[model samples]
Structure formats: C-alpha cells, structure tokens
Target: MEGLSWSASGRDIVRDVDLEVRPGETLGLIGPNGSGKSSLLRCLAGIRPASAGAVRYDGQDIRGWSARRIARHTAFVEQATEAETDLRLGDVVALGRMPFRGRWRGPDRTDREVVDAALARLGLTGLRNRAWRTLSGGERQRAHIARALAQRPRCILLDEPTNHLDVRHQYELMDLLAGTDRTVLVALHDLSLAARYCDRLVLMHRGSLVASGPPGTVLTPGRLRGVFGIDAETGHDRLGNLTVACRGVARDPA
Candidate 1:
C-alpha cells in the first residue's frame, strides 16, 4: 500500500502509511494499543476501503477488485470473528473454499482434502465435528486460522491472531506462519514472538509508519522507548533468536 489512509467520522484512524510485504516472508506489525495496527491490516486486506492512496497486489492496483477475487489471492483473519450460525468446525473451514467454487457447487474431493489438511495442520482434526459455539476461545481462533489455510491463498493478513491462544499454541502458530511459503502480515502485541519469528518488522505509531526494517534494527531500545513508552533491551536468546526484555515503563529523563 502507498499513501494509505482511512478515516472515520471525520477523523483519520489510519494516517498516511506505505508498506510492502515481500513474497514468502513473515512481516510483523507492532504498535501500542490503538496505534491503528488493526485498521492498517483492514486497509491492506482490502476489507475496509482506504480514504486515500492505493493497495496493490503484484504491482496491480486492487481498487476495484471483487471481494471474491481478493479472497482468492489473500485470506484475512480478524482479531475477533463470531459465527452467527452454529456451524460445525469442519463446515466453518470448508467456507474457505467458497472463493474457488460456484454458488451451487458442493464440496468436491479436492475441497474436502484441503479442508481436512487444514484442520490437521491447526491441530483441530479431533474437534472437526464439534459445534463452533461449543469450542473455547483458543479453539475458535485455531478454527479461523484453519479456514484461512483452506483458502490456499498466496498471502495472509491477520490481526492479533494470537490474542486468544495459549503460550504453546501461540508459538506453534507463529512457527507455522513463519515456515509457510505464503506471504504473511500479522499484527502482534507480543514483541518477543515477533522479534523471534518475523523476517522483518514494521512499527506503527499513531496511525503512521514509524519504523520498518529487520527485527533487530526496527526494534531498537530508543524506538521501543519512544513509541511504546517502555525501557527495553534487545538480545539474542540461547537459541540465537532475537528477544525483547522490557525493564519497565519509560521514566522521564532527570
């Protein structure tokens, strides 16, 4: 996206921002609460129209593309998605294949295989028959991710996908996303996870792009203090992965 901005009720929620995700890379979007991370993801996924600028996929502007067309290329998983109907877990995942099927077409062999594979990937195969309403918060989040996987999209845009997951699932999901061939743009609050898994990072502050680069470069102590108001240090863990250790809230200089 170039010069992307979104406004609501006469106030800009996402200010001028330019961002690009490299193919087959996991890019982390980090910011303080209400810094417009979610809004930026919506604009990039083309779910919410931008008040200005353009969103392009492979250099082609997606200004007028149909929702289905966008779905075929990218899958978007919001922070919180509720199902009105009490659909089965498998059925919910099957919805991802809708972009590839005609209105009247039912699940074929390929669709079933894809959905089943997605279920197993997210470790939800055992709960495939469970009612959506019966699942716990973490289970629901995994189901949504499974649905996105079933879409077989080239790119994925997820907003705070780990919000409801446990620590183990959080690491597992991040591992899966980082290892996948699909381009990933994920909004996250966990700085350490983002620093460890993401190939690059983009820090958003007050609805604009503040920093964009490798994890180590973009997540410097000064940037963290200035943007997040936290005094933190960056270092490599025993596994050689980058980690952020926050000391505390930033204190005013004496």
Candidate 2:
C-alpha cells in the first residue's frame, strides 16, 4: 500500500501509511488497541475502500478490481466473525471456494478436497459437522481460519487471530501461519508471539506508522515504553528466541 488513508464517521482511522510485504514473508502488525491495525488490514484487503492512495497486488492496482477477483489472490480473517446462519463447519469452510466457483455451480471434488484439507489442518476435522452456534469461541476462530486456507490464496491478512484461542492453539495457529508459504500480514497484540514468528514487524500508533523493521529493532525498550506505556525488559529465552518481560506500567516522568 502507498499513501493509504481511511476515514469513517468524520474521523481518519488510518493515516497516509506506506507499507509493503515481500512474497512468502510473515509480517506482524503490532500496536496497542485503537492504533488502526484493524482498519489498515481492512483497507489492504479491499474490504473497505481507502479514502485516498492505492492498494496493489503483484504490482497491479486493485482499486477497480471486483471483490471476487481480489479474493482470488488474497484472503482476510477478521478479529471477530459471527455466522448469520446456522451453517455446518464443513459448509463454512467451503465458503472459501466461492471465489473460484461459477455463480451457478456448486462445490466440486477439488473444492471438497480443499475444504477437508483445511479443516484437518486447523484440527477442526472432528467438528466438521458441528453447528456454527454450538462451537466455542476458539473453535469459531479456527473454523474461520480454515475457511481462509481453503481459498488457496497467495496471501492472507488476519487481525488478532489468537484472541479467542488457548495457549496451545495460539502456538499452533501461529505456527501454521508462519510456516505457510503464502505471504502473511497478521495483526497481533502478543509481543512475544510477534517477536518469535514474524520475519519483520510494523509498529503503528494513533493511526500512523511508527516504525518498521526486524522485531529486535521495532520492539525496543524505548519504543515499548513510549508506544505501549509499559516498562519492559527484553532478552532471549531458553531456546534463543527474543522474549519481552514487561515489568509494569510506565509512570509519567514528572
């Protein structure tokens, strides 16, 4: 995205932000609540039209592209999703194939196979027949991810996907996302998870880009204290991965 800006309700939600994600790279978008992460993701996904600037995929501008055409190349998973109808899990996953299917046609063998693979990948195979309203919060999140994966898109943008998940499932989902060959732009609140899994990190603040670089550079103690209002210590864990241990809330220097 170049000079991307989005506004709603007479206020700018995303400023003139400039960003790019390399092919097959995992880029983590991190910031406190109300930092415009969600809005930015929506703009990037073409779910919301930017008030200004452009969004391009494979160097082709997507401003005038159809929704189905965009969905063919990218999949977006929101922070919270509610199923309007009581669709089965398998059926929900199958929705990802919609962009690829003809308007008058139903899912084919390839569609079913892709859906099955997605369900299994997310450990939702046992719940494939379960009703949407009957599943727990975490299950719903996983199902949504399964739906995205079934799209078989080259890129995926997710907003705080680990919100409803347990610790194990959080790691599992992060592993799946980071391990995938597709380009990933994920919004996350977990600093440690972002540090561990993301190849690069983008820090947003008050609807603008604050910093962008490797986790080591972006999640510096000063940045954390300034942007997040937290006093924290950073170090490597036992496995030699970056870890952030927040001491407590930062107090005003007065």
Candidate 3:
C-alpha cells in the first residue's frame, strides 16, 4: 500500500500509511488499540475501500477486483469473534470454501476434503462434529482459524488471532503460523511474540507507521518508549528466542 488513508465521520482513522509484505513472509502489525491496525487490514483485504492512495496486489490495483475475486487470493480472520453456537464445527469451516463454489451448488468431495484438512491442521479434527458453543475459548479461536485456512488463500490476514488462547496454545499458534509457507499478515499486541515469530514487523502509532523492519531493529528501547510509552528491555533469551521484558509504563511528562 502506498499513501493509504481511511476515515469515518469526518475523522481520519488511518493516515498516509504505507506498507508492503513480501511473498511467503509473516509480517506482524503492532499498535495500541484504535491505532488503525484493523482498518488498514480491511483495506488490504478489499473489504473496505481506501479513502486515499492505492493498494496493489501482485503488481495490479486491488480496486479492480470484486470481493469474491479478492477472496481467492486473500483470506481474512477477523478479531475477537465468536463462532455460532448452533453450528457444528465442520459446518463452520466449510464456509471458507465459499469463494470457489457456485452459490447454488452443494459441497463436493473436494470441498469436504479441504475442510477436513484444515480442521486437522489446527488440531481440531476430534471436535469436527462437536457443537461450536461447547468448545473452550482457545478451541473456538482455533476453529475460526481453521475456517480461514480452508479457503486455501495465498495470503492470510489475521487480526489478533491469539486473543483467546492460553499460553501453550498461543505458542503453538505462533509456531504453526511461523512454519506455514503461506504469506501471513497478523496484528499482534504481544511484542515478544511478534519478535519471536514474525520475519518482519510494522509498528503503528496514532494510525501512522512508526517503524517497519526486522524485529531486532524495530523493537529497540527508544522506539518502545516513544511509541508504546513503556520502558522495555529486548534481547535474545537463553534459547536464542527474542524476548522483551518491560520495566513499567512510562509516566506522562510533567
């Protein structure tokens, strides 16, 4: 995206933001809430038209493509969502194949196979026939991700996929995404996870880009204090995983 901007009710939500994700790379977008991370993502997915500038996909403008056409290449997993309680797990995942099927047509053997594979990938195969409401919060989140992967999109855009997961599941999810060959663009609040899992990081503040680069460069103490208002220490752990240890919140200047 070049010179991207978005607004609502006469106020700009995202301003002059520019960013790019390389093929097969995972880029983590990090910012405080209401910093336009979600808005910027929607524009990239073609769900919301940009108020200014242009978003190009594969060297072509994204505006020319229809919603369904865009879905073929990008799958979006919205933040803080709850799966329908009445629906079976498999039924929810099958929705991801919507882009490839005719509306009037029913699921074919291929669609079922894809849905099963996605569920299994997320370790939800045992819950495939279970009711959605019966699953725990982490289970539900994983199921939602399974639905997105079922689309078989080249790029997956996720808005805080780990919001509901436990510590173990959070690590598992990050590792899963890190190992995938697909291009991933995820919004994350956990700086440590971003540093550990993402190949690149984009830091946003008040709807503008603060920094964009590898984690080592982007998560410096200066940027952390300036952008996040936190006194932090960042370095590799004993196992060589990047880690961020925060001292405390920065007090407002007198």
Candidate 4:
C-alpha cells in the first residue's frame, strides 16, 4: 500500500499509510488506542475502501480486482465476531474453501485436506465437530485464524489476534505466524510480543505512521515514551532477543 488513506463519516481514520509486506516476513502494526491500526488492516484487506490513495497487490491496483480475487490473495481475521451462527467448527473452517470451489460443488479432496491441515495447525482438530458458539474466546479466535489459513492466501491480515488468548497461546500463535512462509501483517497491542516475533514493526499515532523499522530500532525508549506516553527501557535477552521494561516517568507539569 502506498499513501493509503481511509475515512469514515468525513473523518480521516488512516492517513497516508505506506506499508509493504512480503512473503516469508512478519510485519507488526503497533499503536495506542484509536491510532488507526484496525482501520489500516481493513483497508489492506479491501473490506474498507481507501478514501484517498490506493492499495496494490503484486504491483497492480487492488481496485481492479474482484472480491474473490482479493480473497484469494489476502485472508483477514478480524478482532471480533458478532455472528450468531451455530455451525460446527469444521463447517466454519470449510467456508474458506468456497473461493476455490465451483458453483454448486462441495469441497473437493484437496479442500478437505487443506481444511484439516489448518485445523491441526491451530490445534482445533479436537473441537472440529463442536459448535463454534460453544468454544471459549481463545478457541474461537484460533478457529477464525484456522479459517483464514484454509484460504491458502499469500498474505494474512490479523487484527488483535492474541486478544483473548492465554500467555502460552499467544506465544504459540506468534510462533505459528513466524514459521509460516506467507506474508503476515498483524495489529498488536502487546509491544513485547511484537518485538519478539516480528521481523519489522510499524508504529502509528493519531492516524499517521510514526516509525517503521526493525524492532530494536523502531521500539526505542524515547519512541515509546513519546507515542505511548509511557516510560520504558529496552534491551536484549541472552538469546539476543529484544526485551522491554517499564520505568516510572515524571508527569509533565501543567
């Protein structure tokens, strides 16, 4: 995406956002509340049209592609679900196969294999037969991701994917994304997780991009304090992983 902008009710929600996500790399989008992270993801997924600029897929304008073509290239897992469907988990995951299926045709052998593989990858095979509504929050989130993976998309866009997951599951999900060869662009609130898992980070503030680079460079203490209004120190662990520690900050005098 280049200079991508989004608006709702005449208000610019995302302004001139430039991003590039390539295969075999993970790009973490981090920001404080209302910094346009979700809106940006929506634009990238083509769910929300760019009000000002354009989004390109493989050097072609995305506006020239149909919805099905876009779906085949990008899979989106949103932050929340409000649907009341009582479909079984497998059925929900199998919905991803619709794009690849012929009209009036059921899932073929390849579709079934892909669905099953996605289920197993997300550790949801045990609940494949259970009603989606019966699963826990974390389970539901994982199931949504499984559905996205079933699409066999070249890129995945996730919005707060770790929101309802436990610590173990959070790490597990990040590891899963990191190990995949597909491109991943994820909105995350957990700065530590972003730093630990993503190859690059993009920080946003007030609907504009503030920083973009490797975690160690973009997540500096000064940048965090300036954008997040929190004082923090950053360092490396024994394995040369970036680590963050919050330190007390002096309040600004009015």
Candidate 2 TM-score over all chains jointly:
0.94
Instruction: Evaluate model 3: give its TM-score.
Output: 0.93
In candidate 1, stretches whose alpha carbon ends up further than 4 angstroms from where it belongs are: 1-11, 82-84
Off by over 4 Å in 4: 1-11, 248-250
CA RMSD of all predictions: 3.2, 3.0, 3.1, 3.1
Can you write out model 2's per-residue Cα lDDT over 1-254, one digit (the tens) per residue? 32222222214788878877788889999999999999989888889887877787877778899999989889999997765678988898999999999989999999999999999999999999999889998999999999999999889999999998999999999999999999889999999999999999999988888999999999988999989999999999889899999999999521
Q: Model 4, range 82-196, lDDT digits (tens) per residue?
A: 6688899899899888778888898889999999999999999999999877888888888899999999988899999999899999999999998998888999999999999
Which candidate should be chosen as best, given TM-score against the real structure? 2
lDDT string, candidate 3, 134-189, tens digits = 88888888887899899998888899999988889999999988888888899999
RMSD of 2: 3.0
Span of ten consecutive residues with least summed lDDT in model 1:
1-10
Write the residue-wise lDDT of candidate 1 on 1-254 in tens digits.
22222222114677778776778889999999999999888877788877777777887777899999989988999996766677998999999999999998899999999999999999999999999899998998988999999999888889999997899989999999999989899999999999989999999888888999999999999999999999999999788888899999999621
Q: What is the lDDT of residue 126 in candidate 1?
A: 98
Top model number, lDDT: 2
Model 2 stretches astray by more than 4 angstroms: 1-11
Off by over 4 Å in 3: 1-11, 83-85, 252-254
